[model samples]
Target chain A: MSLARLSRSQQSNRLPELLVPAALGTLMLIYFAVPFVAFLTRAGTTNIITGLSTPEAQVAIRNSLLTAPISTLIATAFGVPLAYVLARASFVGKRLVEALVILPLIVPPVVGGAMILTAVGRFTPIGSAAATLGISLTDSLIGVILAQTFVAAPFVIITARAGFGAIDERLEQASRSLGYGPLSTFWNVSLPLARGAIIAGIILTFARAIGEFGATMMVAYNPRTMPTRIWVDFIAGGMDAIVPVALALLGITLAVLTAVQRFGRVPTVIDR
Target chain B: MILELKQLTHRYGDELAVDDVSFELEEGELLALLGPSGCGKTTIVQAIAGHVQPTAGRVVLRNRDVTEASPEDRHVGIVFQQPTLYPHMTVSENVAYGLTARGVEPNQRDERVSEYLELVDLTEQWDAYPSELSGGQQRRVEVARALAPQPDVLLLDEPLSALDRQLRERLRKEIARIQTETGVTTLFVTHDQQEAMALADRLIVMNDGRVSGSGTPRALYGSPPTPFVASFLGRSNTFPATVVAQQPPTLRVGTHKLTVSNQELSVSAGTSVTCHIRPDGLSVIAPGSENGTALSLAGEVVTVTDVGRRYDVTIRTERSDEFVVETVERPPEPGEEITLELPRDRITIFETHDHDRGSTTGVPEH
Candidate 1:
């Protein structure tokens, strides 16, 4: 037989073994792609232009852009130290704290929002105390931030912790022996060594904040961030109104996620 | 004392890691803490570095009590076994780290970095990252980094232990030269007896979390006080013997009268004492030469192997004692008659009553 025919027969013989996994993998890919492609095709450049002019679409996109980053900043402030502790410290109750940290990631977003409202809603003790201090979480931007941060903070903490954990402790000790105090060593050695992981964590936090929908809806429906605004428009205009907003959300998030993936990859400064 | 570890004691959980280890180092002295692994030599070094706080002791450097001082506050430069160079930084950056931490001006930092890089013979590797350098070059960078700080005291924690034989020898010599040039008081800890002997002006031999012996390396090699020190420092032949005579200048072992040259120590006659004779102290005499062989014993040649430039000839004596002799000329063939002459002057006598000397009949403790 000719070589080409022999190779073709051999490939055909191997195809039976690969068919199950290939079919399953293709099914998954199609499931993931159908909605995204549909949104893109339905919401053309013309549709986006017209959608941007509408007051609801304009307000909601701006609202999501503004609120998501604020939530990311808040998560960073709380998660950085928590990541360090998780990465470095050995203490009692560490596993419990770890379980608590991972809890928000596993719990349904709606439930996480409900839990936040129960703890800090308008009628709750903390909510009343916050009201006295000119802080209203429920039905406000603060409420939206609280919801987003609750869902997003864990992403930063876990990623940053892994980064810090990979660092060699001897380097820190070397810094200390070289005349840098504990905090200075943290700034000079620990932070710089783990900056990649921390940045990656921050990127994940930002993405999670922007995508947060159920939690945002449960707590701050009036503030109508991008996801909630899309839901409201869908209720009024069905799939016709929903496509443009979905596409807008998908476009911005895809852009940021792409940037985040590139930014989050730990740079190889030493090797090449 | 330029640096003093006074009664330093440390415990890891319930187990004692270092026990009442005390030593004083003069200015510019290079002292080595030498021991086998898990012998607490590292514990003593870390205790002095303030990495591990001793349960009961004082660490005084330059007459200042620094038991409570943090490692950074102690102003001690340390080179670890792993060569802990920051992989993210360039060689020059690693060398400049200490000065930068102390907020040295950029101009002086550059000068000091160049000077130390030159000292370690890595002037060309300054711009290269640690991952790009060879292992030996990385270690040199670590050495330069430690020396750049110019701290009051320097600590080398098995710095050359992880290296190959050639690199270890080179760095050992380099460390000695650098310490002399900088005149920095240093504590070099190592498990290798040869390394300690080559680099240390003074050596502290440790075992089981306690000081087994301490002295100049030559003195320790020639006359290690305990069986532990004798074997740890050199290949000394130690055996249990009853002191037949204890004259100021005479020590008779078995039927042969061995002359004691030092004439300072006088142990009691008839007392049980362990006799140690260093291998180098034993001279090989040609048969029928008439020159005195003080405590001579005839034996059969076991083996003779050439090592480097010299031949290591092993002779199994009539008394079953083995001497690893380093000689220039070719030695007798195996199974041939031979005589090893243990000189009169080179011997250590220690009296012991412990039952740990389990092999009581002509016992040689390990």
Candidate 2:
């Protein structure tokens, strides 16, 4: 037999041994992907395009695009420092705080929404205080942003913390010895070294924010995002409206997922 | 003139990494802090560089106390054991990192980078990333980076330890040459005694978080104050000697009466002592030769192997004491009875009770 044929036969023999798990994994992928496939197949691209431009759909799209990023930014402002501290510093209750941050990720989105509502709902103590200050959290755009951030911040923290932790402590010490001050060393050495992981974390955080559905539904039903819009179209316009919105949402998420996968690959610096 | 550590004591969670150690560096002199790992050599260098704050001490730079100053404010440059070049930058950019941080004029930064790269003989690798360079080439870039800053003092933390033997030797010589040419007060830390001897004008020997001895490399090697210094600085054959007679400037050793000229010592007669003599100072003689082998001791050659230009011979005496002897001619055959002669003046004497004698008993001066 030719070398190609021999290798192919060899591969074919080994393929059965791997086939069980590989097929199962592919089935798992299909299980999650079939809904998107069906949504796309059931509606034309023009339908999706038109569905996204509808006034209600447009408001949902605008609110999602606007609120998710603001949530991510808010998360970053508090999360980056928190991640650094968790990675580098020793303090009381640090583990507790870290666990608390990851809690939202583990809790169901509806439960997370309920918790937010109980704490900041109009009748609760904090909500009463917020009401005194003329600020509303429940059934508002601000509430949606807060819920997305609450769910999203932990992913950034976990990824950024691991990135910071992976860096050799000696690099910072070396920078300091080379006459760079602590702040300069952090900016020049630590930040650049952790850049890839931080970008990955930001992307992950943004994706989590954009995909947030149940919490947004419960906390801010009035302000509909794409996920909320799809829910509404399913209730109001049946499969005709729902399929197109679902397709649009699926396309946006997939595009974001692909971009994140491309950008989040930690670039190996040649010198290191 | 450049830097000095005064009563430096560095404590890390109650464990003293560096005890009360004090030393000074001249403007252009190369000082090597030589010791095995965990001997507090790095702590001293870090303290002087202002990376570690001594629990109590003064780091005097140009006669000014900079003990509390940060590394940047101290104006000291350091080369870590690993090549810590910025991975994103090329060799030239890595070399210019310090200058760039200092906001040096762009032209000057370029000039300084080129100058240091040339000094390190790495100008050809200027555009190469650190990952693309060989281990030796990367270290050269690290040295170049440290030098480009034009700092008052340079601290090197085992800079050549990562390189292979030939590369380490070559780079060490190159470093000594560069230090001499630049006249930057340099403090280098290394475990290799040969490297310290080859590079430093003065050697600071550390042990267990304390300075054991500090002197010119010649002085420390030639006349080690302590047995640890005598043995650690090089190799020296030490013997158990009794001070049967203590003449004004000399003392006798062993059944064979050998005298060492050490007048300042107040060692009395009949006191037990340890006598050390370097290998080069000892000669293998015929059973009874001229001068009658005055300090001769009988031993059997345990191992004899030719080491290029000379023969590396180990001789074990009746007491199972092994002494390494390097001789130009062929060494005595193994199991052969041999008489080793030690010259009187070259012999070193230490008090038997001296704790440092423990370190030299198993080792002989090279």
Fnat for the candidates in order: 0.76, 0.60
True-vs-predicted CA distance for residue A25, candidate 1, Å: 7.9
Model 1 ranges with Cα > 4 A deviation: A1-46, A234-240, A257-272, B87-89, B121-128, B245-272, B283-293, B301-328, B353-366
TM-score of each: 0.85, 0.87
Docking class of 2: medium
> Model 1 — TM-score against the truth?
0.85
lDDT of 2 by residue, B158-201 (tens): 99988889999989988988888898989999999989998888
Candidate 2 residue-wise lDDT at A202: 78
Q: Score the docking of each candidate (DockQ).
A: 0.59, 0.54
lDDT of 2 at B305: 78
Q: Which tens-of-lDDT digit does each residue in A132-229 have in candidate 2?
A: 99888887888899889988889888877877887776677767766688878878888777777777787778888987888887788877888888
